[model samples]
Target: MWDAHMHCHFSGDSDASPESMIASAMDKNLAGICFTDHLDYDYPNEPDAFLLDFESYEKKILSLQQEYDGIFPVNMGIEVGLQPHIADQNRQAVEAHPFDFVIGSSHTCDRLDPYYPSFYEGRTEEAAYRRYFESILENIDTPVDFDVYGHLDYVVRYGPNKNQNYSYEKYADVIDEILIRLIRRDKGIEVNTAGFKYGLCAPNPCPQIIRRYRELGGEILTIGADAHQPEHVGYAFDQIPALLKDCGFNYYTVFTARVPVFYKLPD
Candidate 1:
C-alpha cells in the first residue's frame, strides 16, 4: 500500500513524530509513505500557523530515509495551502525546498477558514457552499505549483450546515474547468478518504468528480488518508484499489523530486 498524504509532528497541527508514523506504516506493511507536512503561508489569524520547519524537517527526513531504507520507502513531502492573493509567496517557499511530493490545498476561502463557524456568519448554507467552490475555482487559475490538489471539497466536511445537499454534478462545469487546468499544468488530484471519517459517503472530490476527472483526460491520481495521527495513517486504504478500478484508473500516482510516477493498482 502507498499512503501519499500524511503529516507528522514536523507540522504544527500534528503531534505524531516521524519515527512513530513510520513505525505505524511499517506495521501496516505499506510499500511507501510520504510526509506531507503543512506549509500554509500567511494564513491570517493563525499566529503560530500550522507549518513545518522545512530546512530541519527535510534534513531529519533524509536521515530517517537511511535508517529505514530496507523497511519501507519513505519520501519527503509537503502540503501547501494555495491561497490566491499569496500565490507568489507560496510558490517561492515551495521552490526553495527539494520535496519529493507536494499537495496543494485550499483551507481558506476569501481569507476566512470555513473550519471556523464564524466564516458562515449571516450567510445561508447554500451561499456559503457556493463561495467555497468559487474560491477553489479562483485559485485554480493562479498558476498552481504542486503535484496534486488536496481535498477539493474540504469545505463541505466542516461547513456550518453539514447535511446540506451538494454534489459534483451540481458544480460539474466549474470542476471540469479546474480539472482541465490541472491537466494542462501537469498537476494531479488526490482521493482524500478523510471525508468518510466525517460521516460523508465519499471522500473529497467524490467518486462522481473522480469519474469526471478521468473523462476529462486526467490519468494521474493519488490516494491519501490525510492522516494527522499514527492510527489514521493508511486508514481505509483497503478500498482504494477497487475505487480506482471503478473510476477507470488502473494506476495510482506517487512522486519523487515533485515528479509523478505511476503504480498499477494491485489486482
Candidate 2:
C-alpha cells in the first residue's frame, strides 16, 4: 500500500515523531509512504508561524532515510496551504526544500478557516456552501506548483451543517471547472480517509467527486489516511482499491520530486 499524505512532529498540529510514524507504516507492511508535513504560510495569529525549522527537519529526515532504507520506502513531502494572495511566498518556500511530493491545499476561505464556526456566521447554509465551493474554484486556477490538491472537500468535514445535502451532483458545474483546471495543470487529487474517522459516511473529496474527476479526464489520484497519530497511519486503506475501481480509476498515484507515478491497485 502507498499512503501519500501524512503528518509528523515536524508539522505544527502533529506530535508523532518521524521514526514512530515510519515504524507504524512498517508494522502495517506498507509498500511506501510519504510524510507530507504542514507548511502553512502567512496565517495571522498562528502561534508558531516562524518557529518551524526546516533545516533541522530536513536533517532529521535524512538521518531517518539511512536508518529505514531497507525496511520501507519513505518520501519527504510537504503540504502547503496555497493562498491566492500569497502564492509567490509559498512557492518560494516550497522550492527551498527537497520534497518528493507537494500537496497544495486551501485551508482558508476568504481568510477564515472553515473549521471555525465563525466562517458560517451571518450566512445561510446555502451561501456558506456556495462560498466554500467558490473558494475551491478560485484555488484551482491559482498556479500549478504541487503534485496533488489535498482533501478538496475538507471544509465539509468541519462545516456547521452536516454535508448530507452537499452532493457532487449539486455542484457539478463548479467541480467540473476544478477538475479541468487540475487536468490542465497536470495535478492530482487526494482521497483523504480521515473523514470516516469523524463519523462522516464519505471520505474527503468523496467517491462522487472522485468519479467526476475521472470522468473529466483526470486520471491521477492518491490515497491518504491524513494520519496525525500512529494508529491512523493507514486507516481504511483496505477499502480504497474497490472504491477506485468504482470510480473508474485503475491506478493510484504516488510521487517523487513532485512528479506523479501511477500504481495499479489489485481488484
Candidate 3:
C-alpha cells in the first residue's frame, strides 16, 4: 500500500527527518510512500510556520528517490492548507514545484483553526461544523491546486463532543454538495486514518462519507496515515484494504508526476 500523505522535518510542525520516515515505511513493507510535508502559506499566528524552502525540500526528496529507486518508491508531495484568499499563492506553489501529488486541506475557518480552542469559542458545535464545511466550499470555488481533499471532516476531531453528536446526515446538504463539486472537478479525497489515532475510532469523514463518495461516483480515493513520526508511518494500514472494499471501492489510488495510478483492492 502507498502512504501518500505524511510529514517530516520539512513540515514546520514536525521535527522528523525524511530519512527516519523513509526507514519506517520500508520497515512497514509499504509498496511506496510520499513526503507530503506541510506548506500552509500565511498560516495564522505564525505566518511562515508551514512554508517550505522548496529548493532544499525538493532536493532532499529527489536524492532519496534516486537512492531508494530499487528498494522502494519515494514520492514528493505537499499538503497546502486551503483558504479562499490564498488561491493564487497555492497555485504558484504547485506550478513551481515538481511534486508528485498535492493535498488541498482546510485547516482553518475564517482565518482561525479549529485545532485551537479559540476557533470554537463563542460558537455552537453544529454552527462551527457548518462553517468549516462551508469554508471548504469556498476553497473549492477558488482556483486552488490539489490532487485530493484531505481529511474532509477534520474539524470533528477537535470538536467539543468529537463526533459523539456528529453524523453525515446532520451535514448532508453541504457535505453532498462538497462531494459533488469535487467529483465535477475531477478531484478526490483521502481516507485519512489519523482519526483513529486521535481516538475517533473512525477515519476522518467517517465510513459514511467514504461510502457516500463512492455512491456519488467519486473514484479517486487515496489512503494515508497522515503520520508525522517514524512509528506512525503506514499506521493501521492493515485495516484499510478491507475497509475500502466495503466502501464499494474496487481500487485505491496513488500518484506519479501528478498523475493518478490505480491499484486493485485486496480481498
Candidate 4:
C-alpha cells in the first residue's frame, strides 16, 4: 500500500509536484508514499542536477506531511546517488534530516554518468557492467548504514541489449558476492518496479536476482514503483505480491525513522 520510492520537483529528473504525486497514489488506493527525491551529490546532470536544498526541502515535505495528516502518511525520503567521495557528505545530510526512508543508488561509475552512452565507450559491455558493480561494491563497502540498496541491476536497464541476454547465471559470482555482503551487513534490496516502465520486461533487479536474494537468506526486501511522475505512482504494483511470493517472500519491508517493519504481502 506504500509506494516506497518516488520523486517530485525535488528530484533533478522529475518536475512533478509532491502533492500531485500523493493524490495519484491515493487514486490508486495506496495508503502512503515516500518521496525519494534525488540527491546525486556530484554529476553532469543539467540545471544543477542531483542536488537538493536540504533545509528548504525538509521544511517543504514536513509541511506536506502535516497537510495530509489524516489522509495518509507522506513519508520524507531521498534517493542518494552513491559516490565514494560524497559518502561522508551524504551521511551528514541524512543525519541533518528526518528522512523516513533512504534509497542508495548508483547512477554513475568512474565519474561517468551511465545515463549517457559514453559510459560504454572503450570497453565491452561485460567490462562496463563489472565496473558498475565494482562501484556499487565500493559504495556499500563504505559500510553503508542505509536501509536498502535500490535497483541492484540498474546498469542492465541501459545496456545496449537491455537485458535481452541478461541472466543471473551469467553474473552469479559478483551478484552472489553483492547479495552475501548485504545479508551479512543486515541490509536489503528493493524490488524497483521501474524496470517494467523502462520496458525491461522485469523489475530493476528482475525476478532472477530477487529469488537469489531470498535463496541466500536475504529477507528485508522492499518494493517501490520508483515513479518520477504522478501518473506513474504505484504503477503495476498489484502484480508484485505474487511475484514476491514466487520469489520466496511472503512479506515486504517498510521503514519509519529508519527502523524496519514487515507487512504481509497482499493476497
Best candidate (score: TM-score): 3
Least accurate 10 contiguous residues by lDDT in model 4:
41-50
CA RMSD for every model? 1.4, 1.5, 0.7, 1.4
Give candidate 1's root-mean-square deviation (CA, Å).
1.4
Give lDDT: candidate 2, residue 149.
Answer: 85
Residues 89-199, candidate 4, lDDT per residue (tens digit)?
Answer: 788887778889888888888888777889989998888888888888888887346889999989988888778877778878888899999899999999999899889
Put down candidate 3 lDDT per residue, 1-267, tens digits, no spaces. 899999999988899999999999988888899999998888889898989999999999999999998989999999999988889989998999899999999998999999998998998999999999999999999887799999999999999999999999999999999999999999999999999999998888799999999999999999899999998998888888888888898899999999999998765
Better of 1 and 4 by lDDT: 4
Name the 10 consecutive residues with the lowest summed lDDT in model 3: 235-244
TM per candidate comes to: 0.95, 0.95, 0.99, 0.96
Clash pairs of candidate 3?
none
- The lDDT per prediction is 0.85, 0.83, 0.93, 0.87
Q: Residues 65-150, candidate 2, lDDT per residue (tens digit)?
A: 78878878888888888778878777787888898888888888888878788888998766776787788777767753788889
Best by lDDT: 3
The residue ranges of model 3 lying beyond 4 angstroms of the native Cα positions read none
Off by over 4 Å in 4: 45-47
Higher-scoring candidate on TM-score, 2 or 4:
4
Candidate order by lDDT, decreasing, is: 3, 4, 1, 2
Per-residue C-alpha lDDT of model 1 across residues 1-267, encoded as one tens digit per residue? 689899988888888998988889889988899999998877769835876677789899999999988878999988988888878878888888888998999989888888899888999777787788778778877765888999988888887656368778777777788889889978889999888778776778788889889999998898889999999888888877888789889999989887788898987
Instruction: Write down the TM-score for model 1.
Output: 0.95
